[model samples]
Target: MRPRFVLPAAFSVAAILLLVSCNRGDLPGKKQLESEQVQASPVAPVASSKVVEELPGAAVSPLTVEQRLEDFDYMWKIIEENYPFLEVNKRLNGEDWLANKEEYRNKIAAVKTDDEFFRRMRFVLSRLNNGHTNFLSKEEYPWYLNTYVQAGFGYEPWINVFQQPNVLARYNQKPLAEQQSPNESNNDINSGEAGSQTGKTSGNVKKVIIEPDQIAYLGMRSFEGSLMEMDSSEIRDFLIEVKDYKTLILDIRGNGGGNSSYWRNNMVPLLINKPITYNTYSLYRGGEYAEAFMQARWLTGGLLPIANIKDEQMPNIPPEATTMFKDYNKNVDIVTPYQSVGFKGEIYLLVDSSVYSSAEGFAAFAKGTGFAMVVGGRTGGDGLGTDPLVAALPNSGYVFRFSLQMGLNSDGSCNEEVKTVPDVEVDPDTSKPLLDQPAIKKVLELAASQ
Candidate 1:
């Protein structure tokens, strides 16, 4: 319930899938599947009861013929019941999701090994074309962690500068005569600052660099650890330090995203001077259990005591719950800016397709409020959905996560269908380091402009 997949750490091949596998609605008793299950409304919950009954954590093992079939059935049923955007996704991608499931289910019996089974499972998930929905075999998880988690450092310009001395020299050795040229603007307040000030805060914010031009750059790799594990005071102090810069560049390229609170509560307030209303409405399947989960999550600040509750104890769902299923018609969240000493200088947000989930949410807020000029490629369009619920397959030990609510922009546009477009779209140059990339240069140019 702690805002599923809120950080870039969750951006692993398996991680994104796992974070989005679970239903955000409720852990209800698995209902019987309808003939046309995909078209059914208020799709049944994945059998929390079955999960509790079958696996018991001791019985789960590698794939057997029967087990593989069961796993396929389990995965398909759960997806059919809880996948939030089958209709929209079908329309957008022109893929027959239900038909794909049936096709994949037939192939399950032919799978000879766990690896093959995993491939088939992945194929089924891939048909959704959703980055958030995914599955990872137990064997694949370790490799995923090693490859993605260890190599999670994305594009950080300041880091590139130190790692490549030539890049530093290019920026630093610009002629002093040129620095004082009549055509140059005096808007760069701390132009005399000598070396770049670079350091990683305990809060996962790496490389806070104040260049000689007084353009402050803060590089954040993932938002997950920084907001939850670190102290808010650290964030406040970091904001206080960078508040004096003439221009601030928040680099979140390749940022997988984390908890929305990290930006909503901590970052947004520091960027905007006034309160702004931003909408991120979501639609969940209507049911008593789902309603209870929604109400509980809202009341507890995104936490739900799912393990403690039984179906009978679920409160009666409100009559309005029926109307809530009208996709994109949900109420708007009028978020008020947090009170703090915020930076009112020119702001730029650096992004890439890897920026997703909570990170994408930050981009949406920044773009929607006009708080910052976005620069870089389109952000990963993964925010327009509810945080997913995770479930473990009883037979295969593979975990699956998926969203249960479709998220919408303030104007009721589907984020899954439309990515967050940057004001200045500059693609990264893989041939050079991040600091030497054209995007960073463009950002610096914008920063230097009067």
Candidate 2:
């Protein structure tokens, strides 16, 4: 059975006490938190550890190398036993699961410092191709960051306001408007050159066409890597140029989330006029009731501080660039509602099961504001809130992530267990053009009726 999401009895009481104190404005000072940290369980218990007797393949190594191999032999053992993914481990194998450790150990000595070990370890973990799995040491626990949490945006793009053209009443805004009426082209501003329209069935898009009359249709693939390091000018200019279209269709069908702040910054310009209240996230404990039941040791064991939340709001401390959290927070900039581009026209967003994490965040934000109409399959990931936590093992220093923060919708309801539902349900209709031109069709259909 799936591990039910619930905290123990004692933990509940402590959480309640802490929450009550905070609510009453009897905030616990740093000393109190420090004291709690000191008293908290440094280690959480898991199943018994199993030692692997032999390497998977007949690979011999030096004594130090062999010992390093053995150390990881134990490390993988502990993780498989304790990790939440029991079924996945069964398939990965009790022995071969240490493939990364062995591969790294075969290359470098295990006797190397923890820093060198983990640096190589992370590279190896990345090879696993599973975003959820990772390794971190307890010592490095304080500096770990699981979420692509952003602080805010550094630059805001400029937006232009233009009088929206009605094709039925104006006939000058339709596709081939230029070819149809030379008079309309004389005074009309050319926002951009009409590119050759490409039509096909790709991964998520059902059917879509690029043409002179259609607003620019954008498809964002994966959301990973560094945004601050990349140039945003091109992206900004692209969105600005597309603004001349009657309606923009943004498709995020298979977007497995990356850095939240990155999307926030990129999408801020598209969100016109006012800042809408985005969804809220909280830790996923069983709420007030579960808080009353959790034990002290379990409550603090492997527990981490979530970045920010509505209730357990993270306070701004002194900047520490050394920590990933601090660095990310400092680099992140939120797009204030009032500072957004107020696009006067309609916007359409499409999503599907592959849409997750930050993609869901983007969809959720767009959904909350009524700025865009979502049309496609429902999102696979939760729409409401997320408990963001990070932790490391004590002995091997293997880093890992857990759903620490639970998320809430704009209405403050729990959505962790429930994935985001679509406004308009759709399946990938491959017989048609890949990009679903439902938005364009809707507009065209409405225009034809008039």
Candidate 3:
């Protein structure tokens, strides 16, 4: 018998979104919601033994040639062992990664200063062309921390980017007469305005209101926080507060994704009415790592003793062995409504190039299921890979992260190769705020009609 696995609550939301396999937790029945609220697990802090220190005026120590080479080799080895999209990457970029590795390896030997070494390492990782695969040096990681504090992490940046004048101008340029065609029935008067009424929900959800229309807007800058951290009850209440509106505009523009479970357990359930099959299938690359993962489960009490090899289906290897194409198989997932009752209102989803990883997955799912009308630009196309495993260099303390599996679309398409196209395509003007854009007005008009 294949041992039944229960989804653990300890996993980070980021990990949960990146690794779909990890989200196979048992779903609570409808009655469960009436009985009590689902409690979220606390997120554990990542522990590192070697603390990176900062010196204001201390002498800068440059990495020696040997240390640089060692760090480069270690980073390269981690990717070689685990990166799941080597074949897809090659096909997309038309570059021989292995050959480039040798070329870059030679270049790394000549890099002198720590700055040069870090830059070179980043350049090498950029060859993968994968947003999830990256190198974060100890010196640079602090910038992220400082920036998050100053700009409110992901939220402020999204607001600043989408609210630019140039961005709003692009939307405003759409012919008002064209928008008011005979086929359109909504009594939407062109406001000719370019700003949104912004507020924060009790849950801290950034709410935007376009004037003259009751359309409710919510922006998901990232899926980073735990469901509890996000205040699920507040979110539910906010939805309830806006449930009477004609439409709900979900703006995920520039959302670089964090955790799928947050949306899955909290947002998704509230939006959906009936049980729907969102994820048709997921493909996993089977190899020594797969077997090792399975074995480790047994030793770690994650698998039952009765589990046998016959239950394990071998992966079908592709013809390109050098490209790391191993056996691939599919898995399915089904989503049901969270509460016995749900929001029956129309939903509009806003997407853009920065909408990546789990956000991309959510967009794909929402679009595939006809759950919402996706508007704006194509998604970032970074959701097709599995969760990344983080590794630190022995000498420089630079961290390398890479995916172990590749996720496929509902139709067995690679999301990394093909972006999720919107139902209504709108070219955003980067110079303006998203609220000021004409697309928001169009979406509002459509929502009013619905």
Candidate 4:
């Protein structure tokens, strides 16, 4: 445990003076602020932010000096070079991680054991408050308990404990899984900690007939597997059946992401006759991770934005950060190779906070191109980039993973920050059971209106 030291009362006056000379035109951070008038301040303001900085966790065992300086330095270099969400997290969560480089290094230098280093690294990631990135020291560090599969089952116990608590909630500040209601197929898939394996190969789209042929519904429980890979005619026949429906509601409320290829091959070819496109943008440092990701995806085109994307919520790209652009015309449009029957009627995507990764990517594609009317709640983002990149500490050999790409939309807003917004916002009626899916009624009403 790190000791908390309150400065003497007399030192408060001096601390205020120094802070005012420093802090300029910035919003108040997570610290408790008391408004006060400052004297002899010209260039800067906001004197009351004389913060009692909370220290990160300490090692349990006593260890040698200079324990892991090189290992930490290597990690810091990678983060500095590639990570794009640093500024976004700072503005949103009030965590200026780059400013506290030495503080984290000092914590790593005194780590008594390998376990302590892992814990300390997790604390470092906690400061970022990101769901896509994490220090994967434990095999199941990200497991969640998703009980929303059925009617009687309620929320998992840990939902009240860790997921999206107050930013300054000390040790509880890590970006825990934003777990929510899951499909029966995704009950074990999302609730990974409970040791239920709803892996890709088995889970398929469940069909629900809302109003016979007039209004149809399909529950895309998880994008973990391909409709083509299962060697089944069920998904194929279902798509062929609903391809001509007047209005189709694709429910992805509890769909946790798996593979981009799942829908890329299955849904896009069969449903999207006219190409659905969005201006895709990416930020990267041309590191090994970026090279491999681009090459693996066979990404072939890019150009700089007309102006350096200036958004208040977006990251202020450093001089070293290169903006990579993707042409949605070629990438998202798949017609010549795979002939699309294309759903002629209106397609409405049903989403909630639980819709994430490739699942959220589907919602984004639908929303971005006006292919589907996005209904229900806003989606979980961090969906536009490739899978996370992994690296190992040279000395300790402890491996971890983090996101290297910061995907953006056409309007220069970050997908990770803005997420996928609904065209028709309908809040889920939490009073009802999870299995009831109360939001669908309003979504259907709104869809018919439009």
> What is the TM-score of candidate 3?
0.64
Off by over 4 Å in 4: 1-67, 138-201, 226-228, 286-342, 429-436
Clashing pairs in 4: none
lDDT of model 4 at residue 247? 82
lDDT of 1 at 132: 59
lDDT of 1 by residue, 1-450 (tens): 122222322111111111211111111121311111121111222213242211112222455798889888877776776566676666666767887666677787887776566666766665676655666333223222222222233312212222233212312222223334311332111121211123223445654565843777776766552233242455566678877678888887766764455565556655666656554545555333234334423422333232322221324222222333522223344444445565767888988877777688778767876878999888776565444554556555565546656655665555655668899989844347656877788888887784
Model 3: CA > 4 A from native:
1-16, 19-67, 139-204, 209-214, 226-228, 280-323, 384-386, 394-397, 429-435
In order, candidate lDDTs are: 0.52, 0.38, 0.53, 0.51
Provide the lDDT at 91 for model 4: 61
Please write out the lDDT profile of model 2 over residues 158-246, one tens digit for every residue: 00000112211111122332233322332111111111012211122222335555556666654332321231333454566665566
lDDT of 2 at 274: 51
Candidate 4 residue lDDT tens string, 280-349: 5566555554454345334424433424444323353332233432122112322221345566888888
Which candidate would rank higher by lDDT, 2 or 4?
4
Give RMSD to native, each candidate. 18.0, 22.0, 17.9, 17.5
Instruction: Give the range where candidate 3 is weakest over 10 consecutive residues by summed lDDT.
Output: 187-196
